[model samples]
Target: MTAELRGTWLYDAHVDLGTPIMVGPTPEGVRAIFPVTGGRLEGPRLKGRFLPHGGDWARIRGDGSIVLDVRALVEADDGALIHLTYGGRLVIPAEIQARVLDLANPDPLAGDRYYFRTLPLFETASPGHAWLNGICAVGVGRVVTGGVAYRVYAID
Candidate 1:
């Protein structure tokens, strides 16, 4: 027997960031830092803007897959603060990876040549949004023009 997975749409996150700071090849992978400037989140359950000074620490592994470690904050309409943290992986074929690295192209990842997914955790102290603290969430992400977009869902 198999169990079906169900989830509710929690939020859509649009994150803005500066150019990645490439750290060159490391023992583990090619490291880079993407500075998160600011952005917004909109959905039925929560709506807010991302706090500044947060960013994603990404690593392009030896196999060309990208690993992401991100941290940020969301302030709901009611002023409740939710701390967001997630780790994700971006898997792409070698041929696609080569195209994505092309500097001449406007949008290297303009097509469906990759898969990006994440597991997100939320933390909050406000009573109104305290339910987030105990929920398990996941997200599907894509590389957008300026940054990245994620459709987050709460597992039910």
Candidate 2:
């Protein structure tokens, strides 16, 4: 099947958003850790997965998947603000989970406070001439603030 994002206006449009996603300074420079995987767009739904940093690797025994959904809506300042939904278990130990209540919430945990803030706008390699169907970013934090560095990734 042809890649959904190929030549789709969002390709470059998303790039313009920026590189080295900004994140707030937290303990351990830990805010800058996001793992992205499975970025494939299906029909009206965009799907992907995100893995937070410092989480227990043992928790993700098998191939883990986080659900992502977005619309084609793009704003002038925000670029493409597609609503995202993440679903999956965090790798933190049960003891840690008890303390970090925020781990369950995708938005806050996926931002600046913990490890999510380090995400760059583009983390996946472009499937030549194809639109991205699914994309995932992993990390732990609260509020993906401005200040954290980012690194842009583009597949040729």
Most accurate candidate by lDDT: 1
lDDT of 1 by residue, 5-37 (tens): 999999998887777789989998999888788
Number of clashing pairs per prediction, in order? 0, 30
Worst 10 residues of 2 by lDDT: 9-18
**Best candidate according to TM-score:** 1
lDDT of each: 0.84, 0.26
Per-model TM values vs. the true structure: 0.88, 0.23
